[model samples]
Target: MAIVKLSTTERRRLSVFFTCLGLAIVAWIFTTLSSPLPFIINEALVYKNSPQKKAFHPLQADTIKITIQGTGWQMLFSKMKPDSKPITVDLTPLESRNYVVLSSQLKLINAKRDANQQITAIDPDTLYFDFTNRLTKKVPVRALLGIDYQKQFAISGNVSIKPAYVTVSGPADRLQKIDEWKTDSIKASNVNESIATRINLQPVTEGNLTIYPKSVQVNIPVDEFTEKTLDIPVKLINNHNYDNVKVFPQKVKVTFTTSLSRYKDMSDDLFEATADLDLWRDHGYSTLPVQLTRFPPFCKIVKVSPANIDFIIKK
Candidate 1:
């Protein structure tokens, strides 16, 4: 095939035509993307201004479809990076009515949003709720703990939580089942010292339920424990016969574990040991078992020497 060479004038004309075509295409694309458009996206719902006297449960899902008006670039970016914040819905109207209209609150809701992206409409414009008898009760607060204490060190006393009870209000059916509300876990490792801090209560997942005072103050006492031995006098009880009844040993050695702070205060007077005489009368038992009737709190009993005592009944 014979090659055809273009003249200098022809080559210049062809280059100018292609350049103008490229610029026109670029301008057209830019103008199209800059125009405002509407797009629909889903947003979670958060309720506020709830009525104190009424208990309400949503009849529909907790999500709403929101239509926003913005430029094509904003719409594309919104699709790529979605908004995670839930839309706050005012439930003040529910005091007199059982339903709320989302369109009525559009002006108030748009105040917090960016001016570039305005919400135009919402699907399911009317949100309805089912009403039931509201019930409020004071329930105990239980703390969940995970602690790793150092050797010879542990919790010395009972874990105390301020305002041990919290007020919970919800539908009667749900409130009746909740006897106690637990706080989030309190975890610690190498817990050699006492813990005094505030912890958050478990969050309410059901929108119908509400708990006052979301957090509580906790105080955990910690100390080192040591072994303590005491010689407690044994008492004879149920001496019905008009005769002398005596136990072979008047005192028995008792070993226990107690906190170091209270070690010096420990004494045999705080404990009581008894050997029941009825054991010999009721059953033909040869020996009476020594029983510890009382002891101080927070003390772990290790061993009670001479568990069984020999008794003599002289009639």
Candidate 2:
């Protein structure tokens, strides 16, 4: 069985060295299958049966897009993570704009990829979303507190909110633009005493908003004051003929600070002291500027003492 031909220039140089080794193995298999290797499955595309009652707007928690076909050295050793069984978009039977992953469900992310690595694709491959209709309302819980009383004490009555109101739900045009529901600042400094706790409901998220009692129970009623002088007796506002205009110390010595439970119901007739004869100051010793016009609510004036008095203009 001898057949060593080896002629005609050695068989045309062995057919040009086997056609240049078959064009270098067809250019290394066409650069390893068209060199496709784009990975970015940060995670999130595994939604299964979402939509728990008409509030669908949050379902892409990982920015997915895994394309693989290796050759970049077998995708750097096939360590391409991201495939814990995701890519499942159920949405409770989808009804509006369906197809959130229909290419045969991408074989459940190509069976967790890695062996032969052929995810080939999976970038939005088909997606759509939009949902609403799930509203409830009760609102009436405003208490963004941040009081810092102590210099003379303040804040008495009507700042409480133990069930004052709450029952928010979202999407009815955003709960009709919400009526009320504030409480997340809640701060207190030096406060003399009294300020209960529990307060957090100012998130208001957005789309699928909700707040049913997220947190509310603030009773700020601090009371620890006691500075009251009250010399009272100085009335005469807009005096144009108040019997002939006359005011030179009619009486003005009110110093405020009530909070000891209304400091004995605060005397001096709740306070009025007025004397603004249009702020008379004709510069004829007509001095006139002590005005109180009623004051009393956590009281804390402190000084007024003839803050400007003595008038007698009578053109």
Best by lDDT: 1
Give all TM-scores, in the order shown: 0.67, 0.30
> Per-residue lDDT for 16-116 in model 1, tens only?
99999999999987897799888888999999888889999999999999988988888788789986668899999999999999999999999988898
- For each candidate in the order shown, give its overall lDDT on alpha carbons: 0.91, 0.70
Candidate 2 stretches with Cα past 4 Å from truth are 1-169, 172-177, 182-193, 199-209, 216-221, 225-227, 231-244, 253-257, 260-272, 275-291, 294-297, 300-313
Candidate 2 to truth, TM: 0.30
Taking the tens digit of each residue's C-alpha lDDT, what string does model 2 give over 1-315? 997978999899999999999999999877875586554433345455544366546544345666666566554544553335444445545655433654656675566555666566766666665576776889798887677887767777678788899987766876788888888998778888887888777865443565676887788887777787878889887656555777788888988877677777778888988876665534434576787878876577989897888766555
Per-prediction backbone clash count: 0, 1
Report the CA-based lDDT of candidate 1 relative to the real structure.
Answer: 0.91
What lDDT score is found at residue 142 in candidate 1? Answer: 96
